[model samples]
Target: MILSGMATPTRRSVLALGLLGCALPGQAEEPIRILTEEYPPFNYTDKGKITGLGTEVVQAVLKEINLDAPFQSLPWARAYETAQSTENVLLYSLNRSKEREKLFKWVGQITPTDFYLFSLKSRNLHINSLEDAKSQNLQIGTVNQDIGEQFLASQGFAVGRNLQSSAKYELNYEKLKLGRVDLWVMNELGAYYMSRQAGDDPAVVLQKALRIPELSGGGNHMAFGLKTSDAVVERFRKGLETIKKNGVYDALQRKWL
Candidate 1:
């Protein structure tokens, strides 16, 4: 089911009073620091601005909860680490994996998505199974701490061996073409979106060599650092539910995907 992840305040005006009503009566509410990276149409930098479907949804959720958070984009690895190390932080479009279940407080899901091992169309690589890809000993480009990286690691793809990790998503895209990495794993939508961002047609530049079902279920979410109060997490969760019920969620999905 569609759920949560977050936004930039410059583009989104905070609502004076959300469903949480925390904006009223001179109450002091702790501000949340929302973080994400370049993984579109989930979230990405667009014309020097952080935006995408996830950004919009999180912005809407902030409005519902009477909360204001600054949306910041960092390299995937740094953002992941910051969210883990800092308190009162919200990270999104996060893949809700079993490996990460206890690391953070999950607010809710954002949207359903598929992950794939992608190869340049020109290479004509064939990977029918994870083992097939592993047997090839081909270098796979990935973003550090991304779900794609973590899943491949679980499958025995080790860094500096078969996995070549970069801090930025677009770097992996470049590595695929430069022949530095034989393949890259990313969300299906991001494959197309990133290709377009680089001014190439995904149909012409890339092909899905294998689909990783392990990365499919509960792929995107908004999660707070473990130290974040349960009360805050519940507030955001309720806010996400509010948007979904009010038809705001569907409108955003249609706009971005």
Candidate 2:
């Protein structure tokens, strides 16, 4: 005869047993793969080492949990795709948006940045708003798979028509300088960084044509794969909160932003 409640485990106990089974020895946890791109002053390679504000913040968060994982800089598109498909993958400096909210488990915000449409100062182009810019039918240059491109696409801008997409932000800047594109869409800080890399003064070369404040205000975040467990996500989230409370977060921001 089968025993009833006397022999059968309760639902809570069964769940606890399952969780314990997952934690047993020989059930190793997967190492996290951190992915980033060459968005300088945030995440970039300096002499073969990935070090920047975002990278440091991620490293600090991981360190708090005694986890050490080096960031790998890949093309933004490739890195984005990898993070989408791979488990235990973390992507940083990713702009948070309503469109992307359900796709990944978010860790925390890393940096604040503003996006703008910039034209060469010499052109004296003036655009008061997105509609004004759109009316002009200007060719806007943006990096492929970038937040700028995503924003423009949401606004009904089509690539190969009015939007020129490049594999890199540097290439987009080059296209703007060469008159291949009428406006360059990028973050304000990134535009400045690219200008400095090209040995040009940002003030002298670029003028902000239109500011997209809605896209700018959300800042960027460290995102984990959708399959990542809540416990893992909370560990990083708590670590980030700890850093903010202890003042490491603000110090990094002051140094980078």
Return the TM-score for each candidate structure.
0.87, 0.87
- Tens-digit lDDT track for model 2 on 61-104? 88777776657999999998899888888999899987789989
lDDT of 2 at 118: 94
Q: What residue runs in model 1 are displaced by over 4 Å at the alpha carbon?
A: 1-28
Please list all clashing residue pairs in model 2, or write none if there are none: none
In terms of TM-score, how similar is model 1 to the real structure? 0.87
Q: Give lDDT: candidate 1, residue 176.
A: 94
Query: Where is model 2 more than 4 Å wrong at Cα?
Result: 1-28
Give me the overall lDDT of model 2: 0.86
Clashes of each: 3, 0
